[model samples]
Target: MPTHSVLIRDQALVTRLLQQYLHLLKTYPIITKSVTSAVLSALGNLLSQVLESKKKRKDGQSGKEVDVYGPLRFAVYGLVITGPLSHHFYHLLELLFPASAPFSLLKRLLLERLIFAPAFLLLFFAVMNTLEGKTHSDLQDKLKARYWPALKMNWKVWTPFQFININYVPVQYRVLFANLIALFWNAYLTSVRK
Candidate 1:
Protein backbone atom coordinates (compact mmCIF):
# COMPACT_ATOMS: atom_id res chain seq x y z
CA MET A 1 0.00 0.00 0.00
CA PRO A 2 1.24 3.48 -0.81
CA THR A 3 2.10 5.75 2.17
CA HIS A 4 -0.24 8.50 0.91
CA SER A 5 -3.08 6.02 0.57
CA VAL A 6 -2.56 4.84 4.17
CA LEU A 7 -2.57 8.42 5.40
CA ILE A 8 -5.81 9.12 3.61
CA ARG A 9 -7.40 6.00 5.07
CA ASP A 10 -6.37 7.06 8.60
CA GLN A 11 -7.82 10.55 8.07
CA ALA A 12 -11.06 9.04 6.78
CA LEU A 13 -11.30 6.79 9.81
CA VAL A 14 -10.82 9.75 12.14
CA THR A 15 -13.43 11.77 10.25
CA ARG A 16 -15.94 8.96 10.52
CA LEU A 17 -15.34 8.59 14.24
CA LEU A 18 -15.80 12.30 14.80
CA GLN A 19 -18.99 12.28 12.80
CA GLN A 20 -20.32 9.43 14.89
CA TYR A 21 -19.51 11.30 18.08
CA LEU A 22 -21.24 14.41 16.81
CA HIS A 23 -24.30 12.38 15.97
CA LEU A 24 -24.32 10.94 19.47
CA LEU A 25 -24.01 14.45 20.90
CA LYS A 26 -26.95 15.60 18.88
CA THR A 27 -29.06 12.64 19.97
CA TYR A 28 -28.05 12.59 23.63
CA PRO A 29 -26.28 15.76 24.52
CA ILE A 30 -26.35 15.47 28.30
CA ILE A 31 -25.50 11.79 28.40
CA THR A 32 -22.67 12.14 25.91
CA LYS A 33 -21.18 15.06 27.79
CA SER A 34 -21.63 13.31 31.12
CA VAL A 35 -19.80 10.19 29.99
CA THR A 36 -17.04 12.23 28.39
CA SER A 37 -16.65 14.28 31.59
CA ALA A 38 -16.56 11.16 33.74
CA VAL A 39 -13.80 9.56 31.71
CA LEU A 40 -11.68 12.71 31.53
CA SER A 41 -12.13 13.55 35.19
CA ALA A 42 -11.11 10.07 36.23
CA LEU A 43 -8.05 10.27 34.03
CA GLY A 44 -7.17 13.61 35.58
CA ASN A 45 -7.26 12.18 39.08
CA LEU A 46 -5.16 9.24 37.95
CA LEU A 47 -2.64 11.60 36.40
CA SER A 48 -2.41 13.56 39.63
CA GLN A 49 -1.84 10.38 41.64
CA VAL A 50 0.83 9.21 39.22
CA LEU A 51 2.68 12.53 39.45
CA GLU A 52 2.48 12.47 43.24
CA SER A 53 3.87 8.95 43.29
CA LYS A 54 6.77 9.99 41.08
CA LYS A 55 7.46 12.98 43.29
CA LYS A 56 7.52 10.77 46.34
CA ARG A 57 9.98 8.38 44.71
CA LYS A 58 12.21 11.29 43.74
CA ASP A 59 12.16 12.66 47.29
CA GLY A 60 13.26 9.31 48.78
CA GLN A 61 9.93 8.83 50.49
CA SER A 62 7.92 5.64 50.47
CA GLY A 63 5.20 5.81 47.85
CA LYS A 64 1.70 5.80 49.20
CA GLU A 65 -0.74 3.33 47.75
CA VAL A 66 -2.98 4.88 45.11
CA ASP A 67 -6.38 5.61 46.52
CA VAL A 68 -8.56 3.57 44.21
CA TYR A 69 -11.61 5.62 45.17
CA GLY A 70 -10.11 8.94 44.15
CA PRO A 71 -10.78 8.54 40.46
CA LEU A 72 -14.17 7.05 41.16
CA ARG A 73 -15.14 10.11 43.15
CA PHE A 74 -14.03 12.39 40.37
CA ALA A 75 -15.97 10.32 37.84
CA VAL A 76 -19.13 10.62 39.87
CA TYR A 77 -18.66 14.33 40.34
CA GLY A 78 -18.07 14.87 36.66
CA LEU A 79 -21.10 12.89 35.63
CA VAL A 80 -23.50 14.22 38.21
CA ILE A 81 -22.35 17.81 38.46
CA THR A 82 -19.85 19.09 35.94
CA GLY A 83 -21.47 17.75 32.77
CA PRO A 84 -25.05 18.79 33.39
CA LEU A 85 -24.07 22.09 34.90
CA SER A 86 -21.68 23.07 32.12
CA HIS A 87 -24.08 22.04 29.38
CA HIS A 88 -26.83 24.23 30.79
CA PHE A 89 -24.53 27.03 31.80
CA TYR A 90 -23.22 27.44 28.28
CA HIS A 91 -26.74 27.43 26.94
CA LEU A 92 -27.78 30.08 29.41
CA LEU A 93 -24.88 32.22 28.38
CA GLU A 94 -25.95 32.05 24.75
CA LEU A 95 -29.51 32.98 25.66
CA LEU A 96 -28.42 35.83 27.84
CA PHE A 97 -25.92 37.29 25.43
CA PRO A 98 -26.51 36.48 21.82
CA ALA A 99 -23.57 36.86 19.46
CA SER A 100 -25.03 39.93 17.79
CA ALA A 101 -25.45 41.83 21.04
CA PRO A 102 -23.02 44.63 21.76
CA PHE A 103 -20.24 43.60 24.17
CA SER A 104 -21.64 40.04 24.21
CA LEU A 105 -18.17 38.64 24.46
CA LEU A 106 -17.27 40.81 27.44
CA LYS A 107 -20.61 40.14 29.10
CA ARG A 108 -20.20 36.40 28.83
CA LEU A 109 -16.64 36.53 30.09
CA LEU A 110 -17.51 38.66 33.09
CA LEU A 111 -20.55 36.58 34.02
CA GLU A 112 -18.62 33.36 33.75
CA ARG A 113 -15.45 34.48 35.47
CA LEU A 114 -16.95 36.70 38.11
CA ILE A 115 -20.06 34.78 39.05
CA PHE A 116 -19.94 31.25 37.72
CA ALA A 117 -16.33 30.51 38.49
CA PRO A 118 -16.50 31.28 42.20
CA ALA A 119 -19.80 29.52 42.67
CA PHE A 120 -18.60 26.46 40.81
CA LEU A 121 -15.48 26.22 42.93
CA LEU A 122 -17.52 26.32 46.09
CA LEU A 123 -19.82 23.65 44.76
CA PHE A 124 -16.85 21.48 43.87
CA PHE A 125 -15.37 21.75 47.35
CA ALA A 126 -18.66 21.11 49.06
CA VAL A 127 -19.54 18.12 46.91
CA MET A 128 -16.10 16.58 47.18
CA ASN A 129 -16.20 17.11 50.92
CA THR A 130 -19.52 15.33 51.20
CA LEU A 131 -18.33 12.53 48.93
CA GLU A 132 -15.30 12.09 51.17
CA GLY A 133 -17.66 11.80 54.17
CA LYS A 134 -16.30 14.84 55.84
CA THR A 135 -18.25 16.87 58.39
CA HIS A 136 -19.88 20.27 57.85
CA SER A 137 -17.24 21.76 60.10
CA ASP A 138 -14.62 20.24 57.87
CA LEU A 139 -16.27 21.80 54.86
CA GLN A 140 -16.27 25.19 56.52
CA ASP A 141 -12.64 24.81 57.49
CA LYS A 142 -11.76 23.83 53.96
CA LEU A 143 -13.52 26.88 52.57
CA LYS A 144 -11.76 29.15 54.95
CA ALA A 145 -8.41 27.67 54.15
CA ARG A 146 -8.64 27.00 50.45
CA TYR A 147 -11.48 28.88 48.80
CA TRP A 148 -9.81 32.22 48.24
CA PRO A 149 -6.56 30.71 47.02
CA ALA A 150 -8.36 28.38 44.67
CA LEU A 151 -10.59 31.14 43.38
CA LYS A 152 -7.56 33.30 42.78
CA MET A 153 -5.85 30.52 40.93
CA ASN A 154 -8.98 29.87 38.93
CA TRP A 155 -9.22 33.51 37.90
CA LYS A 156 -5.59 33.51 36.84
CA VAL A 157 -5.74 30.28 34.85
CA TRP A 158 -9.27 30.09 33.51
CA THR A 159 -9.96 33.73 32.65
CA PRO A 160 -8.28 33.73 29.26
CA PHE A 161 -9.40 30.22 28.40
CA GLN A 162 -13.00 30.98 29.31
CA PHE A 163 -12.85 34.09 27.13
CA ILE A 164 -11.80 32.01 24.16
CA ASN A 165 -14.20 29.22 24.89
CA ILE A 166 -17.23 31.46 25.27
CA ASN A 167 -16.51 33.66 22.30
CA TYR A 168 -15.00 31.32 19.72
CA VAL A 169 -16.10 27.73 20.36
CA PRO A 170 -19.43 26.65 18.95
CA VAL A 171 -22.17 26.10 21.52
CA GLN A 172 -22.45 22.39 20.80
CA TYR A 173 -18.73 21.79 21.33
CA ARG A 174 -18.30 24.12 24.32
CA VAL A 175 -18.61 21.44 26.94
CA LEU A 176 -16.10 19.24 25.18
CA PHE A 177 -13.61 22.10 24.91
CA ALA A 178 -14.06 22.87 28.59
CA ASN A 179 -13.66 19.22 29.49
CA LEU A 180 -10.41 18.98 27.57
CA ILE A 181 -9.07 22.00 29.42
CA ALA A 182 -10.42 20.60 32.66
CA LEU A 183 -8.19 17.58 32.22
CA PHE A 184 -5.32 19.71 33.49
CA TRP A 185 -7.59 21.87 35.62
CA ASN A 186 -8.87 18.76 37.35
CA ALA A 187 -5.34 17.69 38.14
CA TYR A 188 -4.68 21.09 39.65
CA LEU A 189 -7.94 20.83 41.58
CA THR A 190 -7.01 17.41 42.98
CA SER A 191 -3.69 18.77 44.14
CA VAL A 192 -5.34 21.78 45.75
CA ARG A 193 -7.95 19.66 47.52
CA LYS A 194 -5.25 17.52 49.09
Candidate 2:
Protein backbone atom coordinates (compact mmCIF):
# COMPACT_ATOMS: atom_id res chain seq x y z
CA MET A 1 0.00 0.00 0.00
CA PRO A 2 1.32 3.44 -0.97
CA THR A 3 0.00 4.87 2.26
CA HIS A 4 1.80 2.26 4.33
CA SER A 5 5.18 3.93 4.09
CA VAL A 6 3.79 7.42 4.58
CA LEU A 7 1.90 6.16 7.61
CA ILE A 8 5.00 4.62 9.17
CA ARG A 9 6.81 7.91 9.78
CA ASP A 10 3.80 9.67 11.18
CA GLN A 11 2.86 9.18 14.80
CA ALA A 12 -0.70 9.77 13.69
CA LEU A 13 -0.58 6.62 11.56
CA VAL A 14 -2.78 4.62 13.92
CA THR A 15 -6.14 5.37 12.33
CA ARG A 16 -5.08 4.70 8.74
CA LEU A 17 -3.53 1.34 9.63
CA LEU A 18 -6.68 0.08 11.29
CA GLN A 19 -8.70 1.37 8.36
CA GLN A 20 -6.62 -0.87 6.09
CA TYR A 21 -7.33 -3.85 8.29
CA LEU A 22 -11.04 -3.12 8.29
CA HIS A 23 -11.09 -2.92 4.50
CA LEU A 24 -9.18 -6.17 4.19
CA LEU A 25 -11.62 -8.11 6.40
CA LYS A 26 -14.62 -6.78 4.54
CA THR A 27 -13.13 -7.86 1.26
CA TYR A 28 -13.87 -11.51 2.03
CA PRO A 29 -17.21 -13.35 2.23
CA ILE A 30 -16.34 -16.60 3.98
CA ILE A 31 -15.53 -14.70 7.12
CA THR A 32 -18.50 -13.78 9.22
CA LYS A 33 -20.04 -10.49 8.15
CA SER A 34 -20.63 -9.54 11.74
CA VAL A 35 -16.91 -9.85 12.38
CA THR A 36 -16.14 -7.53 9.51
CA SER A 37 -18.62 -4.94 10.73
CA ALA A 38 -17.23 -5.17 14.23
CA VAL A 39 -13.73 -4.47 12.93
CA LEU A 40 -14.94 -1.47 10.99
CA SER A 41 -16.62 -0.21 14.12
CA ALA A 42 -13.39 -0.71 16.03
CA LEU A 43 -11.47 1.28 13.46
CA GLY A 44 -14.03 4.09 13.53
CA ASN A 45 -13.92 4.26 17.31
CA LEU A 46 -10.15 3.98 17.44
CA LEU A 47 -9.63 6.58 14.75
CA SER A 48 -11.65 9.10 16.71
CA GLN A 49 -9.35 8.71 19.66
CA VAL A 50 -5.58 9.22 19.96
CA LEU A 51 -4.01 6.14 21.39
CA GLU A 52 -0.63 4.67 20.53
CA SER A 53 -0.89 1.23 19.00
CA LYS A 54 1.10 -1.69 20.48
CA LYS A 55 4.82 -1.51 19.74
CA LYS A 56 4.50 1.33 17.28
CA ARG A 57 3.25 3.75 19.87
CA LYS A 58 5.82 2.81 22.45
CA ASP A 59 9.05 2.34 20.50
CA GLY A 60 8.56 4.50 17.42
CA GLN A 61 8.29 2.65 14.10
CA SER A 62 10.71 -0.13 13.29
CA GLY A 63 8.76 -1.18 10.22
CA LYS A 64 6.62 -3.42 12.41
CA GLU A 65 3.21 -1.97 13.31
CA VAL A 66 0.82 -3.43 15.79
CA ASP A 67 -2.69 -2.50 16.83
CA VAL A 68 -2.91 -2.11 20.58
CA TYR A 69 -6.45 -2.03 21.85
CA GLY A 70 -8.87 -1.52 18.95
CA PRO A 71 -8.48 -4.89 17.32
CA LEU A 72 -8.63 -6.60 20.65
CA ARG A 73 -11.98 -5.07 21.43
CA PHE A 74 -13.27 -5.95 17.98
CA ALA A 75 -12.12 -9.52 18.51
CA VAL A 76 -14.10 -9.72 21.70
CA TYR A 77 -17.31 -9.15 19.78
CA GLY A 78 -16.30 -11.44 16.92
CA LEU A 79 -15.56 -14.33 19.24
CA VAL A 80 -18.47 -13.90 21.59
CA ILE A 81 -21.21 -12.90 19.18
CA THR A 82 -20.37 -13.09 15.46
CA GLY A 83 -18.90 -16.58 15.19
CA PRO A 84 -21.28 -18.27 17.60
CA LEU A 85 -24.43 -16.72 16.21
CA SER A 86 -23.57 -17.55 12.61
CA HIS A 87 -22.90 -21.17 13.52
CA HIS A 88 -26.08 -21.44 15.53
CA PHE A 89 -28.17 -20.06 12.70
CA TYR A 90 -26.37 -22.21 10.16
CA HIS A 91 -27.20 -25.34 12.14
CA LEU A 92 -30.74 -24.22 12.65
CA LEU A 93 -31.22 -23.72 8.93
CA GLU A 94 -29.18 -26.57 7.50
CA LEU A 95 -29.64 -29.28 10.09
CA LEU A 96 -32.86 -28.69 11.94
CA PHE A 97 -35.09 -27.51 9.12
CA PRO A 98 -36.53 -29.64 6.33
CA ALA A 99 -34.96 -28.94 2.95
CA SER A 100 -38.02 -29.25 0.70
CA ALA A 101 -38.88 -26.41 -1.67
CA PRO A 102 -41.70 -24.82 0.28
CA PHE A 103 -40.16 -25.93 3.54
CA SER A 104 -36.80 -24.51 2.52
CA LEU A 105 -38.40 -21.22 1.69
CA LEU A 106 -40.32 -21.18 4.92
CA LYS A 107 -37.32 -22.40 6.86
CA ARG A 108 -35.08 -19.77 5.39
CA LEU A 109 -37.69 -17.16 6.16
CA LEU A 110 -38.08 -18.35 9.70
CA LEU A 111 -34.33 -18.63 10.25
CA GLU A 112 -33.87 -15.07 9.24
CA ARG A 113 -36.85 -13.64 11.06
CA LEU A 114 -37.08 -15.75 14.20
CA ILE A 115 -33.39 -16.52 14.53
CA PHE A 116 -30.78 -14.66 12.52
CA ALA A 117 -32.06 -11.20 11.70
CA PRO A 118 -32.74 -9.80 15.14
CA ALA A 119 -29.71 -11.53 16.66
CA PHE A 120 -27.46 -10.19 13.94
CA LEU A 121 -28.69 -6.64 14.31
CA LEU A 122 -28.55 -6.68 18.06
CA LEU A 123 -24.97 -7.95 18.07
CA PHE A 124 -24.14 -5.48 15.32
CA PHE A 125 -25.28 -2.59 17.45
CA ALA A 126 -23.45 -3.89 20.47
CA VAL A 127 -20.21 -4.44 18.56
CA MET A 128 -20.52 -1.09 16.84
CA ASN A 129 -21.06 0.64 20.14
CA THR A 130 -18.06 -1.10 21.68
CA LEU A 131 -15.90 -0.28 18.68
CA GLU A 132 -17.19 3.29 18.56
CA GLY A 133 -16.40 3.89 22.23
CA LYS A 134 -19.99 4.04 23.34
CA THR A 135 -20.89 2.75 26.76
CA HIS A 136 -22.92 -0.41 27.27
CA SER A 137 -25.79 1.54 28.79
CA ASP A 138 -25.75 3.95 25.90
CA LEU A 139 -25.91 1.09 23.42
CA GLN A 140 -28.70 -0.58 25.36
CA ASP A 141 -30.75 2.59 25.42
CA LYS A 142 -30.15 3.27 21.73
CA LEU A 143 -31.36 -0.21 20.91
CA LYS A 144 -34.49 0.32 22.92
CA ALA A 145 -35.18 4.03 22.50
CA ARG A 146 -33.42 5.08 19.32
CA TYR A 147 -32.51 2.32 16.84
CA TRP A 148 -35.74 0.34 17.09
CA PRO A 149 -37.76 3.53 17.02
CA ALA A 150 -35.73 4.89 14.15
CA LEU A 151 -36.42 1.70 12.26
CA LYS A 152 -40.13 1.97 13.03
CA MET A 153 -40.73 5.64 12.27
CA ASN A 154 -38.50 6.03 9.26
CA TRP A 155 -38.68 2.54 7.85
CA LYS A 156 -38.61 4.08 4.43
CA VAL A 157 -35.29 5.63 5.27
CA TRP A 158 -34.19 2.54 7.14
CA THR A 159 -34.96 0.39 4.14
CA PRO A 160 -32.77 2.67 2.09
CA PHE A 161 -30.04 2.23 4.63
CA GLN A 162 -29.86 -1.37 3.44
CA PHE A 163 -28.68 -0.29 0.01
CA ILE A 164 -25.43 0.77 1.58
CA ASN A 165 -25.48 -2.31 3.74
CA ILE A 166 -24.20 -4.37 0.80
CA ASN A 167 -20.94 -5.17 2.55
CA TYR A 168 -22.72 -6.86 5.43
CA VAL A 169 -25.40 -8.76 3.49
CA PRO A 170 -23.91 -9.53 0.08
CA VAL A 171 -26.49 -12.11 -0.97
CA GLN A 172 -28.49 -9.75 -3.12
CA TYR A 173 -31.90 -11.29 -2.52
CA ARG A 174 -31.31 -11.60 1.20
CA VAL A 175 -30.22 -7.99 1.25
CA LEU A 176 -33.45 -6.99 -0.42
CA PHE A 177 -35.52 -8.99 2.03
CA ALA A 178 -33.64 -7.58 4.99
CA ASN A 179 -34.24 -4.10 3.67
CA LEU A 180 -37.96 -4.72 3.40
CA ILE A 181 -38.01 -6.08 6.94
CA ALA A 182 -36.13 -3.05 8.19
CA LEU A 183 -38.71 -0.80 6.56
CA PHE A 184 -41.55 -2.64 8.24
CA TRP A 185 -39.85 -2.75 11.61
CA ASN A 186 -39.09 0.94 11.45
CA ALA A 187 -42.64 1.81 10.60
CA TYR A 188 -43.99 -0.52 13.27
CA LEU A 189 -41.69 0.81 15.96
CA THR A 190 -42.59 4.39 15.20
CA SER A 191 -46.29 3.71 15.34
CA VAL A 192 -46.01 1.94 18.66
CA ARG A 193 -43.48 4.20 20.40
CA LYS A 194 -44.05 7.57 18.81
Candidate 3:
Protein backbone atom coordinates (compact mmCIF):
# COMPACT_ATOMS: atom_id res chain seq x y z
CA MET A 1 0.00 0.00 0.00
CA PRO A 2 3.04 2.31 0.24
CA THR A 3 3.58 4.62 -2.72
CA HIS A 4 6.69 4.32 -4.95
CA SER A 5 8.22 7.60 -3.75
CA VAL A 6 7.63 6.72 -0.10
CA LEU A 7 9.32 3.33 -0.52
CA ILE A 8 12.27 4.97 -2.29
CA ARG A 9 12.58 7.53 0.50
CA ASP A 10 12.61 4.81 3.18
CA GLN A 11 15.21 2.83 1.27
CA ALA A 12 17.32 5.95 0.87
CA LEU A 13 17.18 6.66 4.61
CA VAL A 14 18.30 3.14 5.42
CA THR A 15 21.12 3.38 2.90
CA ARG A 16 22.31 6.64 4.37
CA LEU A 17 22.31 5.24 7.87
CA LEU A 18 24.25 2.19 6.77
CA GLN A 19 26.75 4.32 4.92
CA GLN A 20 27.38 6.48 7.98
CA TYR A 21 27.89 3.43 10.16
CA LEU A 22 30.29 1.88 7.71
CA HIS A 23 32.20 5.12 7.50
CA LEU A 24 32.58 5.21 11.30
CA LEU A 25 33.68 1.58 11.31
CA LYS A 26 36.22 2.24 8.62
CA THR A 27 37.53 5.60 9.74
CA TYR A 28 36.96 6.05 13.45
CA PRO A 29 37.09 2.67 15.04
CA ILE A 30 38.89 3.68 18.23
CA ILE A 31 36.73 6.76 18.68
CA THR A 32 33.66 4.61 18.41
CA LYS A 33 35.04 2.32 21.09
CA SER A 34 35.74 5.31 23.36
CA VAL A 35 32.18 6.58 23.02
CA THR A 36 30.71 3.14 23.60
CA SER A 37 32.98 2.56 26.57
CA ALA A 38 32.12 5.93 28.10
CA VAL A 39 28.39 5.39 27.74
CA LEU A 40 28.48 1.88 29.17
CA SER A 41 30.80 2.89 31.97
CA ALA A 42 28.33 5.60 32.97
CA LEU A 43 25.50 3.08 32.90
CA GLY A 44 27.49 0.69 35.07
CA ASN A 45 28.27 3.42 37.56
CA LEU A 46 24.62 4.38 37.69
CA LEU A 47 23.80 0.80 38.58
CA SER A 48 26.53 0.83 41.17
CA GLN A 49 25.05 3.95 42.74
CA VAL A 50 21.58 2.42 42.90
CA LEU A 51 22.84 -0.82 44.41
CA GLU A 52 24.91 1.02 47.00
CA SER A 53 21.98 3.23 47.90
CA LYS A 54 19.76 0.18 48.37
CA LYS A 55 22.32 -1.55 50.56
CA LYS A 56 22.66 1.53 52.72
CA ARG A 57 18.92 1.86 53.06
CA LYS A 58 18.63 -1.78 54.08
CA ASP A 59 21.25 -1.19 56.76
CA GLY A 60 19.29 1.75 58.34
CA GLN A 61 21.63 4.29 56.87
CA SER A 62 20.28 7.33 55.07
CA GLY A 63 21.44 10.33 53.00
CA LYS A 64 24.12 8.42 51.12
CA GLU A 65 25.91 10.66 48.70
CA VAL A 66 25.06 9.94 45.09
CA ASP A 67 28.57 10.53 43.88
CA VAL A 68 28.57 11.75 40.31
CA TYR A 69 32.36 11.66 40.45
CA GLY A 70 32.38 7.87 40.37
CA PRO A 71 30.65 7.77 37.01
CA LEU A 72 32.79 10.62 35.73
CA ARG A 73 35.93 8.72 36.67
CA PHE A 74 34.54 5.63 34.98
CA ALA A 75 33.82 7.63 31.87
CA VAL A 76 37.29 9.15 31.83
CA TYR A 77 38.96 5.80 32.34
CA GLY A 78 36.92 4.26 29.60
CA LEU A 79 37.54 7.13 27.21
CA VAL A 80 41.27 7.40 27.82
CA ILE A 81 42.43 3.93 28.75
CA THR A 82 40.22 0.85 28.47
CA GLY A 83 38.66 1.70 25.15
CA PRO A 84 41.84 2.17 23.13
CA LEU A 85 43.74 -0.59 24.91
CA SER A 86 40.98 -3.10 24.26
CA HIS A 87 40.60 -2.04 20.66
CA HIS A 88 44.32 -2.53 19.98
CA PHE A 89 44.73 -5.59 22.15
CA TYR A 90 41.98 -7.50 20.38
CA HIS A 91 43.53 -6.62 17.05
CA LEU A 92 46.92 -7.83 18.18
CA LEU A 93 45.38 -10.93 19.66
CA GLU A 94 43.75 -11.72 16.34
CA LEU A 95 46.98 -11.05 14.51
CA LEU A 96 49.04 -13.30 16.75
CA PHE A 97 46.43 -16.03 16.92
CA PRO A 98 44.19 -15.97 13.94
CA ALA A 99 40.89 -17.70 14.65
CA SER A 100 40.84 -19.76 11.49
CA ALA A 101 42.84 -22.77 12.63
CA PRO A 102 41.87 -25.65 14.86
CA PHE A 103 41.74 -24.84 18.58
CA SER A 104 42.34 -21.18 17.82
CA LEU A 105 39.38 -20.21 19.95
CA LEU A 106 40.72 -22.20 22.85
CA LYS A 107 44.14 -20.72 22.43
CA ARG A 108 42.87 -17.16 22.33
CA LEU A 109 40.61 -17.75 25.27
CA LEU A 110 43.36 -19.18 27.42
CA LEU A 111 45.82 -16.50 26.47
CA GLU A 112 43.33 -13.76 27.22
CA ARG A 113 42.16 -15.25 30.48
CA LEU A 114 45.60 -16.12 31.76
CA ILE A 115 47.69 -13.21 30.59
CA PHE A 116 45.54 -10.19 30.02
CA ALA A 117 42.92 -10.56 32.73
CA PRO A 118 45.21 -10.53 35.74
CA ALA A 119 47.35 -7.73 34.40
CA PHE A 120 44.31 -5.70 33.51
CA LEU A 121 42.84 -6.18 36.97
CA LEU A 122 45.93 -4.80 38.57
CA LEU A 123 46.00 -1.91 36.18
CA PHE A 124 42.35 -1.21 36.75
CA PHE A 125 42.75 -0.99 40.53
CA ALA A 126 45.85 1.11 40.24
CA VAL A 127 44.24 3.49 37.81
CA MET A 128 41.04 3.75 39.77
CA ASN A 129 42.93 4.36 43.01
CA THR A 130 44.98 7.01 41.37
CA LEU A 131 41.83 8.58 40.05
CA GLU A 132 40.51 8.65 43.60
CA GLY A 133 43.59 10.68 44.58
CA LYS A 134 44.87 7.92 46.81
CA THR A 135 48.55 7.93 47.63
CA HIS A 136 50.85 5.04 46.75
CA SER A 137 50.53 3.27 50.08
CA ASP A 138 46.78 3.74 50.02
CA LEU A 139 46.63 2.36 46.51
CA GLN A 140 48.79 -0.60 47.52
CA ASP A 141 46.60 -1.27 50.52
CA LYS A 142 43.45 -1.10 48.40
CA LEU A 143 44.96 -3.50 45.92
CA LYS A 144 46.00 -5.91 48.65
CA ALA A 145 42.52 -5.80 50.11
CA ARG A 146 40.47 -6.09 46.94
CA TYR A 147 42.58 -7.55 44.14
CA TRP A 148 42.17 -11.30 44.58
CA PRO A 149 38.49 -11.18 45.35
CA ALA A 150 37.89 -9.04 42.31
CA LEU A 151 39.98 -11.36 40.16
CA LYS A 152 38.04 -14.36 41.32
CA MET A 153 34.82 -12.54 40.54
CA ASN A 154 36.17 -11.48 37.16
CA TRP A 155 36.92 -15.06 36.28
CA LYS A 156 33.48 -16.12 37.34
CA VAL A 157 31.91 -13.74 34.82
CA TRP A 158 34.43 -13.23 32.03
CA THR A 159 35.50 -16.80 31.37
CA PRO A 160 32.42 -17.84 29.46
CA PHE A 161 31.96 -14.40 27.93
CA GLN A 162 35.46 -14.36 26.47
CA PHE A 163 34.95 -17.80 25.04
CA ILE A 164 32.05 -16.48 23.04
CA ASN A 165 33.85 -13.25 22.28
CA ILE A 166 37.07 -14.69 20.92
CA ASN A 167 35.36 -17.50 19.11
CA TYR A 168 32.20 -16.03 17.68
CA VAL A 169 32.52 -12.26 17.42
CA PRO A 170 34.06 -10.73 14.34
CA VAL A 171 37.15 -8.58 14.86
CA GLN A 172 35.41 -5.33 14.02
CA TYR A 173 32.59 -5.96 16.47
CA ARG A 174 34.57 -7.52 19.29
CA VAL A 175 35.17 -4.31 21.25
CA LEU A 176 31.56 -3.25 20.91
CA PHE A 177 30.47 -6.68 22.07
CA ALA A 178 32.83 -6.50 25.02
CA ASN A 179 31.55 -3.03 25.91
CA LEU A 180 28.00 -4.33 25.86
CA ILE A 181 29.01 -7.12 28.21
CA ALA A 182 31.05 -4.66 30.22
CA LEU A 183 28.02 -2.60 31.17
CA PHE A 184 27.03 -5.41 33.51
CA TRP A 185 30.60 -6.43 34.25
CA ASN A 186 31.56 -2.90 35.16
CA ALA A 187 28.61 -2.65 37.49
CA TYR A 188 29.82 -5.82 39.17
CA LEU A 189 33.34 -4.48 39.28
CA THR A 190 32.30 -1.16 40.77
CA SER A 191 30.21 -2.82 43.45
CA VAL A 192 32.87 -5.37 44.25
CA ARG A 193 35.53 -2.73 44.65
CA LYS A 194 33.38 -0.97 47.23
- Checking candidate 3 for backbone clashes, the offending pairs are none
TM-score, prediction 2: 0.38
lDDT of 1 by residue, 80-152 (tens): 9999999999999999999999999999999999999999999999999999999999999999999999999
- Distance from true position, residue 169, model 2, in Å? 12
Order the numbered candidates by lDDT, best leading: 1, 3, 2
CA-lDDT, candidates in order: 0.94, 0.48, 0.86
Q: Kindly report which residue pairs in candidate 2 clash with one another.
A: 151-186, 152-186, 152-187
**Segments of candidate 1 deviating more than 4 angstroms:** 1-12
RMSD of each: 2.0, 13.1, 4.2
Top-lDDT candidate index: 1
Stretches > 4 Å off in candidate 2: 1-72, 124-140, 149-194
Of candidates 3 and 2, the better by lDDT: 3
Q: Against the true structure, what is each candidate's TM-score?
A: 0.94, 0.38, 0.86
> Which stretches of candidate 3 lie above 4 Å from their native place?
1-22
**Global fold similarity of model 3 (TM-score):** 0.86
Error of 2 at 88 (Å): 2.5
